[model samples]
Target: MSATPPPTSSPELKRVVTGALVGTALEWYDFFIYGTAAALVFNRLFFTDSDPAAGTIAAFATFGVGFVVRPFGGVLFGHLGDKIGRRSTLIITTLIMGVSTGLIGLLPTHPAIGVWAPILLTLLRVCQGLGAGAEFGGAATLLAEHAPPGRRGYYASFAQTGVQIGLVLGTSAFLLVQLLPEEDFLAWGWRLPFLVSFALIGVALYVRLRVAESPVFREMERTREIVRLPIKDALARHPRNFLVGVGAHINDTAIVYTLSTFSVAYATAELGMSNHGALFGVILFALTVIVLQPVYGNLSDRVGRRPLNLFSVVFVALFVYPYFLMVDTGVPWLVWLAMMIMGAFGFAPQVAVQPVFYAELFGARVRYTGFAASRELGAALAGFSPLIGAALAARLDGAPWLVAAFLIGTAVISFVAFYASRETKDIDIADIADIDIAGIDPVRKPVAEE
Candidate 1:
């Protein structure tokens, strides 16, 4: 029999992409706002009375708290996503993120609540982590499952674009608060951005509600083939793919967290840049990311995933040192240049194509579980890179090179991990699940119905 032709796009494709974008944007807005708060307000508001350095460390530790909870979120949500449907899982995650972030805006400070202030803050952060962990994997898998065969990378890249949109909005909000009087900004202005998330979340929920379920998922449901134990199946059948996905994702997460979140503190504390100056750098880089995501994603469609990902890893290794040097020079324009290059060109390739690449590592039955688990595992490592970098910087007496060395080591590990995996560019989506763990050809078998 002739092979089944790859599916073509319909009006449904547009709807799926729109849903992915809106939901992803809302989730990331929630995530990025916490990072902004950690940099500017959390140190003083939650960790008061500690030494300045200790306060900063404590605030960042809370930031990492969210990352710590992600893997459990991935497992919980991934199971539901694989068994129930992607559309429902995404909507649930969006609500969790939106509600948690809005409540953070309304929370009372340390003076009002004493030690309970940081405790409440950390608890909310864990909720944010739970939502964020599930959101990206579902969105990416939904988009990829709906996309036409040759354009999965291009379509799925919109999910990453949503992340850039969130960064733009979140960082821009923080920058706006900087314009207020210091007393006003510290007292009330910071709360404004968190409160505004309510409106954005409402809009995202409306848009997402209108989109239909993914066609591939629908077909699986029709065939009664949805795996009941997705995580177990993924672990048993695709261990190598899972490990490789973790490795490929680590460097991308590290670079982004370092540049956007950690850099704010690093620039101010070590490089002697003002808070406004560091925020401006973040804004510039966020804009660059917005512009570059689609370009690199489309490039992956043309050239391939392995080459582009490898190039990104190598570029980061080479660029981290120079990037820090430029930032340390305290030249505002040079800092802008450095951030733009790092965000737009250095990190774009892997970040843009990863949704499609990582999702494709497993078959449709376990795509959500495999992708979510591996991606969060990788991010777990990255989640700690900043803390490590901070400690290394302290030990080396504010030496940026030491941090650069650590980032380079992460890049090296990622490169080796990805190098060991099979390229999935031309593989048929339905056939991906049955592929061997050792990167060999699939042992062709009859397709099973749910």
Candidate 2:
């Protein structure tokens, strides 16, 4: 076995977890602001030429464009992360996302810039996508590598929990902005949230700079186990594991987008509810996620990740139809209840453990690349979910049945992927090289015995 560094200090572990939490929170806050804007304002602001339905489709398409560029970002930064170090890659991604988001707040509307408005918007969205592509994987990998053996799931989950906090901040920001008059809101009020994101960047940078580098990566460098091309090594050496990570990741992105982004448009535009009401529902659900994700992650350390993940996917598949039914009622209480059930209960478990689950799939040499590349590739399927949901609703005479079915299909794909993969909760990070990429071993036993 390679000589792993001594365990991270207690205070240092706290600092590292705090940095991961703060940095990801700020980055996702920027990302989520765009999603909120795409649903609430972008169609009218950027795609004015099309009818309302067509405009929403176009706007959400731009949202998906970010996802399109994410895999590239993952490959680019994942390589740097694997080669150089996690700390530096994180700082670079933070600056890229922060700058792109701040610039978006300053962009002129279609009426002012004509065609250039959307062209610039798409370009900036690409930058945002690239930045986001590396954030989760990097954060998760860093935290998992730092965490103590039995508590990796709990520590790694803080990254995603921070993301949920970002969702709450972003949704709440929009809710506050939604209070303005309709004319002013459509004109200038919507830019406030994006503009405020600049301050968050400063705070995130401060926290991130304070944290030490991942001990696992340092040990790799000390032991000279670092690979030349992490992406190539990950693919060539671990194809099955990479594919498994991709399949396991699809539903996490798809399900979240369906519940949060598309449902915002579905509730407001199609159901005739107010944006305030929808944003409120989103805020409530996000708050629930912040509280539950860690609990679920901690639970996974005891019960195992596969059962929780499988249960969550199956639960979402079953609940999505009724979830939409509640939304269509135009009653705020029912919608809130439905979102709480879906987000806090059904969705939280998968998301809670996903970071650790993917990070655990690879050995130290290619962990960053394997986790980032595969997860973002899966994100490509999810990136267009809101756009697809919009189209499905339009095609079905404004009903959400087809959209719900599509969500169920994605869930099943993820379930199958998780079912086929082996559990890694008990695997030692230092000894991971003893296991093959396909999760097979002649001597070492599987973590979870059936």
Candidate 3:
């Protein structure tokens, strides 16, 4: 919002990137651990029912509960992030997420406390949701604002890289604990993963606290350009970008969960795959995503975000049927290959350009609120995907075609979104608020006196 923007230097970029990436990885570790637990252990451990099928559904319901409140969390924290500073807002969100996850470790189960166990479990999950709702939006905004324009996609993509790393760390934690005796695992091993959130909180706080606030937000503040209500403006002024942001998230959210969370369960329960084997596929998928995110991001920087966005969804759409078909084979190598392919072609490019794409979609004044609230609302909508996949499989006698069709539907939504959006790789992120949605009218003057 300042009349003149500040220059970004190479040194500052590295520091911001590290802080944002590391903090995001740690915070999302808390979130991913809960998802892995809901898939693997919570069904049996927390619920009162002995029916494995019912319990699994109940466990997944709790997982869905966390997503239910994410939009609220995004709006709340996004407002703070837009109103206050990105650095301080992110610190608070980190604390909220880490502390809630750690407490989940200490909660008693159904045998110990009956119905209270699940009720309390869902409560803690909501807290995690609130914290996570805006974590990536804030991190990406910070990194994007600090990055040089030509390489904005490359720099901001590290936040997504952190996301893959979190998934790996979370799955690795479960994989290690799975080696324990079954009795010990059900009794205590499951809690170990959640407990790690405590230590992660300390490390995350150190890094997040050191990170500087976004220069764009700081400039807005210095120029007295901060809006009284960011979320409202985001919706009222940039409705097209907001809707596109929501749709842009549908495919990745649904497909990633279908691949990572639901597939893990479906493989073990239906395909007769071992727990360890199915989880290994997840690790492979995450590693592939971790490697490809930056590659796609750097490529987006060169070729522009639109091309990658469009190509990524179409390729992923064509692969959905094969992804399920390969997983149904019951061969370890086949399953691993299947998951990796989904990660590379299905999930990577969309996520790679995602952060900077959202950053470019809205002006500085509403960036955090718009980017976070819109994306998380989409996530909340697709958050039930694993539950949907499981329910569909159960009804159709384990047939996966319905689920495949379901996934293709989400991909179509995201493809329309990507196609509808204008190119933003060349836009001035700091000055977008000055132009109206049609890009021809003056929305506001950058300087206060004007």
What would the TM-scores of all predictions be? 0.95, 0.96, 0.97
Error of 2 at 373 (Å): 0.4
Worst ten-residue run, lDDT, model 3? 441-450
Which lDDT tens digits does candidate 3 get at residues 132-225? 9999999999988888868889989999999889899989999999999999999999999899999999999888776777788778888898
**Candidate 2 lDDT by residue in tens digits, 260-293:** 7899998988788888888899888888888998
**Each prediction's whole-model lDDT (CA):** 0.82, 0.88, 0.87
Ranking by TM-score: 3, 2, 1
**Compared with the true structure, what per-residue lDDT tens digits does model 1 show for residues 278-358?**
888888887888788888878887788888889889999999999999988878889889999988767888889888887
| Local distance difference test, candidate 3 | 0.87
Model 2 deviation from native, Cα RMSD in Å: 2.8
After superposition, the stretches of candidate 3 with alpha carbons farther than 4 Å from their true spots are: 434-450
TM-score for candidate 1? 0.95
lDDT: which is higher, 1 or 2? 2
